[model samples]
Target: MEIFRNKKTFTDYIERQKEMGKRIGFAPTMGALHQGHLSLYEAAQKENDLVISSIFVNPTQFNNPDDLEKYPHDTNRDLKLLENTGIVNAVYLPEVADLYPAGLKSKAYNFDGLENEMEGKSRPGHFDGVGTVVEELLRQVKPDNAYFGEKDFQQLAIIEKLVQQLKLPVKIHGVEIYREDNGLAMSSRNERLNAVQRDAGKVIHETLVKVNDWFRIITIAEINKRVKDIFDDQRGMTLEYFEIADEQTLKQTDFFYKDKNYRAFIVVNVGEVRLIDNMHLD
Candidate 1:
């Protein structure tokens, strides 16, 4: 697979591919490659003539400096994993300087009401950073299609909005979340968890599953109480927020609307790693 660290070379290569009438599919990632990331590459491979994946741990997205510093990285291993997939045609590995040659600039994005809840409220400037980097990458690659996992369901919604607002000629596709055998959602942060913490993390998924099963029969307040009770009972897991929200707008709903689809979103701190997961509650 071809590796590019410079933006001009990467853009030139992409342009050449476009000239050849190739339909390019892109997967933008923050490295720490795992089965979850490879799944995105697999999905992209099926639909496009050529696939490109980028690994740039964007600093702009992190509201906490310590969280950014502690974020995982292993370039050699990431490339090996991508090579093993044999689906990625090229890999874009850019330094912070490469992405922000002019240095960082503050930016803002309006996601309608989607950005006002959950992660946005928790992380402050997180979605703005996400919007900035994703917009830049989409511009640089200019692919026909871009793939993102539904694991970050809210972020996926924001990206869809970003594409619409910017009038970019790319289609955004959200793949289903990849999970571990025990039902915990696969995440790069899972690397930081010890065996005990890893097992404890399963409670997050279990709680979501319980909510999914009972959401139809119970009131939203009872659902919230049940979820809190589960977290309180767990030794190592600390619940951040659990909400039943309209899937489209991501605004918390007090009652399940018969006309709208809903989802349960959860965040938990297992040891030092913060994990997020969502389940569709139909």
Candidate 2:
């Protein structure tokens, strides 16, 4: 796949594609590619004539500077993997300046109620940074469709809402979360976990699995307690939040949800790496 690091070159390439009447599909990612990310690439290839993926580790999204500094990067390996995928047409490896030029004021994008809980509440301004960078990338690519993983379920919901609210010409599609054989959800952060931490991390997924019950309706606090109990059983792991909420609205539920659609999610710290996982409450 062709690689363009500068904005002008990437835009020109897109211009040529537009002239050829090719439908564009884009996947935005911070480097450290994995099977979960490649799955999005596969979905994009299936539905669009041209597929573009961006590999920039966005700085503004991190509330913790240390987390930003420690985030994984290996562009050479990532490029090789993308090339092998046979699905990515071009990879946009833009510098931070290319996306955010000097003296360009920061733009604010928030989902009101949805932005204040779970990951957002824990890491303030996290989604604003996510929205800012995603808006910039979506505007730059101007794709007919964009693919995101359900692993970042809340972020996917937020992006969908942004596209609808702004009338962007892109359709957002979500790929299901890819998991390891032992059930730990695949994530770039998984690379940072030590052996014990990685083993303990499975508890996050298992807690959700054990707690999910009664598709019709069940008390949210009861489910929340069930998840917290599982986390409590695992030492050295701190529970950040356990929630069951409307998938689209993301508002936490206390009473039983009569509506059949929602999600069970958790964010817990296994050592310094914060892992988030969710299972659809069917």
Candidate 3:
């Protein structure tokens, strides 16, 4: 895989590819590469002539300093993983200066109230950071297609809104969430969880599955209470927020509407590591 640590060279390469009539696909990540990330690459490769990616753990997205400090980082392993796929033609490994040349700040965006949803409500200024780095990367790459994992369903919605507000000519694709054999959503943060905590994390997916089964059969209120009770019983897991919301707008709904599709979003604090997962409440 071609590696780029500089902006101008990266853009020049992308321009050359575009001039050759290549359709580019892009996926921006925070570097601790996993199968979930590669899955996006595979999806991109199927439709685009070339696929590119960026790996920069953006600092502005983190509300907790410790979370930032504790984020998983493994450059060698990440690079190796990307290389193994042979689908990624280039990967941008930018320093803070390379991405944020203007002294590190997120551009102000009102993702049309998408900025105030679940993850947004839980962590302040999170989407601003997400929007900033994403906008920066998308501008530089200018790909025809972009891919994101559905594991962060809310963030995916926010990014779709960001792309719209910016009026960028790119299609955003949300690939299905990748999971461990036990159904826990795959994440870099999973690296921090001990074996015990990892096993405990299974409860998250289990609960999501139960909610899926209970979705329209029971009242929303009872389902909410049942979800809470399940997590409340787990020893090391803390239920952060669980919402069954409109599938498209991401607006949390108290009751399932007859005309709208719904999805269940949940965040669980497993010990110190925060885990997020969502299931379509079909």
Candidate 4:
């Protein structure tokens, strides 16, 4: 597969592809790829003639500098995996300056009500950064469809909203969240955890499931409190937020077990790693 590290080269490559009249499928990621990320490529490959994958660790989307610094990176390993896929047509490995140049302007797109809850509440200005970068990528790549992992359910929601609100000519499709055998959601940050912390990481999703199960009869407030209690009971886990909300609108609800179409989400800190996960009731 062709690798483009600069705009001129990447844009030229895309122009050539356009001349061939091939449909493009794009997947944007911040490196340290796992099975979850590969699943996105598989979806793209099945539906499009060409697959474009980007690996840039976005600095703007990161709320904590330390967290951003600690986020995993292994271009060599990632390339090996993508090469095995045999479906990736090109890989865009843009530099930080290329994505957001020195003294460059940054733009933010408001995701209406979806940008200020759960992960947004915990990481202020996070979605704005996400919107800025994603908008730029979509405009540049102009793919027929883009694949996003449902592990970041809220981020996917915001991107879908951005496309609709701005009328960007691209479809945003979400792949189901992938997890390890122990049930911890797969993430690049998982590499940061030591063996014991890795085991403790499972508690985050398990707690999400436990809290979601509680929604069957308890009030949202009670369920939220109970979710927090699990983290309180567990040592070294910091609860950021545990929320139950309407899946599409992301507005917090009193309770949702009866509706059977709501979503349960949680964001918490395990040592230095910040993790988030969500489950659909239906």
- lDDT at 162, model 1: 95
lDDT of 3 by residue, 1-282 (tens): 799998889989988998999999999999999999999999999999999989999999999999898888889899999999989999998889877899788778898888888888878899999998998899999999999999988889899988887799999999999999899999999998999999878889998999989988999899999999998888988888888999788898888778999999998999888889999877
Off by over 4 Å in 2: 102-105, 214-218
lDDT of candidate 4 over 129-218, digit per residue (tens)? 888788878877889999999999999999999999999999999999999878899988788888888898888878777766776666
TM-score of 2: 0.95
Go through the candidates in order and give the clash count of each: 0, 0, 0, 0
Q: Which ten residues in a row have the lowest lDDT in candidate 2?
A: 213-222
Reference-based lDDT, each prediction:
0.90, 0.85, 0.91, 0.84
What is the overall TM-score of model 4 with all chains considered together?
A: 0.92
Collision pairs in model 1: none
For candidate 3, give the lDDT of residue 77: 91
Counting only residues 3 or more apart in sequence or on different chains, how many pairs clash (N, Cα, C under 3 Å) in candidate 2? 0
TM-score, each model? Answer: 0.98, 0.95, 0.98, 0.92
| Ten contiguous residues with the weakest lDDT in model 4 | 99-108
